[model samples]
Target chain A: MPYTAEISRTNPGCFIFLVDQSASMSDPIGSGEMVQQRAQVVSDAINRLLTELSVKCAKEEGVRDYFHVAVIGYGHTQVGSAFTGGLAGRDLVPLSEIANNPARLESRTKKVPDGAGGLVETTVQFPVWMDPVTNGGTPMTRALGYADSLVARWVDEHPGGFPPIVLNLTDGESTDGDPTSAAIGLASHATADGAVLLFNLHVSGASGTPVTFPDGEGDLPDTYSRLLFHMSSVLPSHMRSYAASQGHRVSDATRGFVYNADITSIIEFLDIGTRATELR
Target chain B: MGAHSTHLDVQWFLVPKTGSSSEECEDAIDVLLSPETSSLFAAVSDGASESLLAGAWARQLVHGAVALMSAADEESVVGQDGLSRFVVEDLLARTVDQWDGYLAKYEAERIARGRPITWYEQPGLDKGAFATLMAVHMREAPADPENPKAVRRWIWRAFALGDSCLFHLRDGRLLTSFPITDGHGFGITPQLLGSRNRNASLIADRVSTATGELRTEDELLLATDALAAWLLSHPEVDSGGAGRQLGRLADLDQELFAEWVQNERDKSRMRNDDVALVRMRVKTEG
Candidate 1:
């Protein structure tokens, strides 16, 4: 089985990463000054997913030949740059060049643990695609609608095969509109062999309890989380291997959401998700 | 002639990625010809390009069909209407039933491994592997001296699931031909001859158009897609003449014909498929 069911290294599916750039995510997590900032952690995690996906493309034939991928970041009620293209608010660009292009360094910093029991701050340039932007309210509902169009077109072309996966990393409710219907529609579009999988990475509040939605409660105003979770693709085996290598163990049963302030869970999730999609 | 006498010549053309392997080709051809009373039967099955293991499927059909029919002890038919028609139908049914079982076991194995089943999601038909089949049975003619040129009669009943060809040539002219089943272009291309939803029975019924007498000085040539294209392009060369050439093949260098085919003939006109040719000379009139 592939990593993200639909997105492969070859004709890798399009992944629209809807990051929560609403000023709140910048806060430190759990009163731990020692831990890296949440924004930095999220960016690091996205970078890790991109690296894992790129490596998979080089090693796996099916992933290299069949999978085509694109990453779109939605934040502050508007679309941001694609992970590979760096274009501001462009439509999804299929990932043909990203896998073949030479690796270049993008400026990003993270705290590395000093081997001698203490934590030493280290700044390293990483391969970056989309920079985090914080501007307005979370338009998660609108993002889901946009995802529906993108995914639906892909499914129309590959109806008898696995539908592409859409993984959304968000921490709050949508301010634009109800995203439940769009998410539901996305989940229903699958191939004859397998269906589309949508998963959400919920980064909880820093100081307070994390806000989670779609907890089987009809009272929730939006079903954004519910639909995203439902549309998440199956976690492939090799991705689990990558996650295990990254010191995060995940099983096949693990769905889209892995919530915590550490943001490491999101990194692991994307790593696994990207790797699974690369499988033949 | 004794009923036990076998007369048909079978050549299995492994079309690049299609058809049975050389090792299994004999066994598969034997299976399609298992009727003891009428020992002569020839078949050429072209593997589906879309399938991952099209060659294996073709081999399985031939071997399984012959074994099943032989065990059943089906009555032997007479003439073109009898032999070709009956054998094609019988082989098709037997092959299909066995194929269903094969698929069932395959699915079971997938379930055991806890892997998502995608065995049937072969690449698109245009780019994928698939097979076509053509089988023929010949009977000995009666011993009659009235007509010196009296030739044996042949029942050339054929079934085509894919693009392979079954040709009958008499006096250097085309006697009759079977239609190739052109399937839906995209998605799962329809199985023209082999088992995949549409089996030999349905395809034989749909594609079979010619059924009649085959006279001596006549030749029946059955081929896979590539060789069929090659044979069709070279209209000037008589296969009957080629059949005669086989007798003198050992005296000449083996490279001569291949060199002629590649260097002398128009390169694009040749079929890239594995070629299987069967030629029988009629000795008596039926």
Candidate 2:
């Protein structure tokens, strides 16, 4: 027989979350919630996402064989050990460990209706991966660069594997330098046979239209949206399904933010990223 | 009122071009070794290279089917009859079920990993993971207390669902050759494939020609796609070659078998197809 190779068993894919924790993130939106408060909502969403993932992985042999998750945050130039305050420097960590830590700063709690006339209460954790320090300028460029390197390293280890996904949540423009170059650099990484996909969640306080891909002159800065769009990889099959099922609901195209007063938008963003990254 | 005991050698090869391997074969064999039937039934599944995961699908078919067969009552003639059909029907159903379950879990895992879930889209049924199956049930009949050659044997049957086959040669005379399935021609385009058309039932053939007398010179060759291509390349081979070359190649050198396959593949007679062959020689009369 000619050389026959073992095909890889079908695997789901991996997802990494990159959150922004700059001091400017503390700025309050137009009579709504501040960036600091929104961080808790996103964290709650991450916790919910983890719960859903664990349930799904337990039932699937291939899913367990193929999937992994990590979270990274950027702010005050510190990385790693979200709850412990020990800086590991621009790295991602699993969710369960973060949930167990007591030293992590707590974001505000909110109780929103579950659509059944019942209120569901939740606590938001600050900086799941990297925390923000108020001392310096916004390093959106460096953050993008770090995220790019992270995804590249992930794909190199998983050849013939599903591509990795990066979901970067940001509030402001790059103050340290131009972010366009870093965005392009991030777009260049891919597996031997596949590619990495990145999504940008631009959180703004102004009333505007939500530009997911960003062209010229919409709600948020079109240039930033375009840059992020350029850095993003094509939507995979799974990611498309997820987006179709939940993206619209979470990230209202009409609203310029990923979430509203409640903190549910973070879950929606995750839904979009999760579903979009599943493309084969 | 009752019967017991079972023994048989089962073998298979993965279609090379299709990217199936002997490792998968070994996995199928492990499943086949279960204590499910008194007359062990062996199978080989060849994946269609034109489809993705066909090889893995083929291996899954054999292993899953064998696991199903082990639970069948080997001594009950009527029960075996129903089981023969159930093995195919139930096995296919189980495989599909397993696949769906895997997909669901895979999707969830993606979410947990903070990734999305994507399902592969094939134009038609044959485009997704699909494989051909060939299987046989063999049992050694009770021996005449003092004479081993007098031992009666029963070949419950050799069954197929889709293209794989089982063949037997009695003193160089071709007795049987099962043919591959010609599933819906929708495979011609990328837009035609769907889950409904992946596998098709080819033919069900049981050979009982050599039951009465046993000869050590008899030979049986069970094969999937690739090996079939080689046998077809010989001077006088065709769709009927499985039944034609049975006993004729018994005494032929094993090297010739390998060479025939190689030459045919090189000549494109086999088209670099995945080939899996199982050659068996009756060592003793019983």
Candidate 3:
């Protein structure tokens, strides 16, 4: 019954993203063609996730505040809000404010099918809320702790609403200390619907194949991914079915962790709106 | 083709999502019944909540379907076997063709209201508003045209493209359900009719058509996804199920229907979505 609460404008859900801004994030992320700095990758991931969420909840009037969101950056000495532009210094803001207050919109071009078996070039406005910043050490422990405070406050405020979802985007390098206890503490926050959900995304320069939402850490090549995986919560059933529908192999044991792969699809898993269920 | 003594009592109940207003409800219904005639045209559409102008498009679909059905040949009402592909294909094509004009008027209204299209709403608008449609054309006819002693019966031809369903009941027990078989069959991504879709063949392929006859006291219910899913999930058992609820709920007014839907939503027995239901029963006057 937990995680079954209706996410609506009146009883909104929460999303707290923890982004790693450590010096190690300055290094390149992937092995193949599309390589980017870990900081940029995580920043883009967060932005893309936000964009998708906004679009998913958009209506004729405007984007409804079905979720309140926060972006926290952790590096060097301090862990704080990462939003830029009009929303700078804000912790948890309504989604409509985030949608309207992006730092700037960049014109990006992409190829699309032209309906005649050919491709057409189109320019789209990409909104950016945070820029890549790489500083000193990876203080992931503090990042999770930061999210814990926000989740605790959110659950207290909306005890009958859907529990907050905390997603940690890191490089698996925690300089301050072991972040396991902090991760556990963050995931323990609860609302009347269910306990807070903690999902992890590891974007690192480490040499390995990227895995997403694995049922176990058995195939992980190193300790970093294994640690991140173990810290993650089991995929909620509503999201599990959606992810499975999207061609991802998942089961009851699937954890909400991704290693060097796109977790933006997870945004699609959130049920902010409805159509009908099409035949499988 | 002539007016008959047979009469059908029709009623509809509508409820928006728990926190939303009636104006914000995406479900739509349009019915056309001429005075002193037994023939009726009805359409119900459930708009995709994620799409822009979905409610308007849903309203447009129902109105258009009923209007078009009014002009179509009465004898073309399909039987238990095959459906006229042209009729369904034409219905969708005509609706899609008119969407551009609707969009133009909507744009003007939005600009006048100072809420011009924003970046986030662009994608959903470009993809077009999508909704599930179920429509029916019903009329009274002789039970057996060749048999002089046969009584009259009501015949209905219906087409469904998504989770919105049609139910036939006899003596308060469900005899059949269309488009969606059971409650578990409903999901978030129902087959949608896009406002900009022009593929007649594709639309016809996905559409499911059913024809049935109702006796003097039999009932027919056409409902949007939320109520339809809940109704279909509860099987027609001899002791309880849809039978008990049907008898009690058939006469509920707007306020009571809203309360019933909210009660079910509170208990988590039904998903929190907008609900629309059309209830009809056949009657004969002496």
Best by TM-score: 3
Cα error of candidate 2 at position A195, Å: 5.5
Candidate 3 lDDT, tens digit per residue, A119-189?
A: 99999888999999998998988888888888888988999988888877777579889999999898888
TM for candidate 3 is 0.91
Q: Which of the numbered candidates is closest to the native, going by highest DockQ?
A: 3
Q: Could you arrange the candidates by TM-score from highest to lowest?
A: 3, 2, 1
True contacts kept of each: 0.00, 0.00, 0.84
- Candidate 2 positional error at B14, Å: 11
lDDT of 2 by residue, B1-286 (tens): 3443324433333334322233433112222443533355566766543344444566666666555555553542124333343444565565655665654564577689985432111122223455566655455455777886553564434555444555565654445555432222112111211123424232112211112222444455667644554454345443345435533443355456545555765565564444566655434322
| Candidate 1, B-chain TM | 0.58
Model 2: residue A42 alpha-carbon error in angstroms: 2.2
Q: How much TM-score does chain B earn in each model?
A: 0.58, 0.61, 0.91
Residue B277, model 1: lDDT of 45
List iRMS (one decimal) for every candidate.
12.4, 12.2, 3.9
Error of 3 at B39 (Å): 0.5
The DockQ score of candidate 3 comes to: 0.57
lDDT of prediction 3 = 0.80
Better of 1 and 3 by DockQ: 3
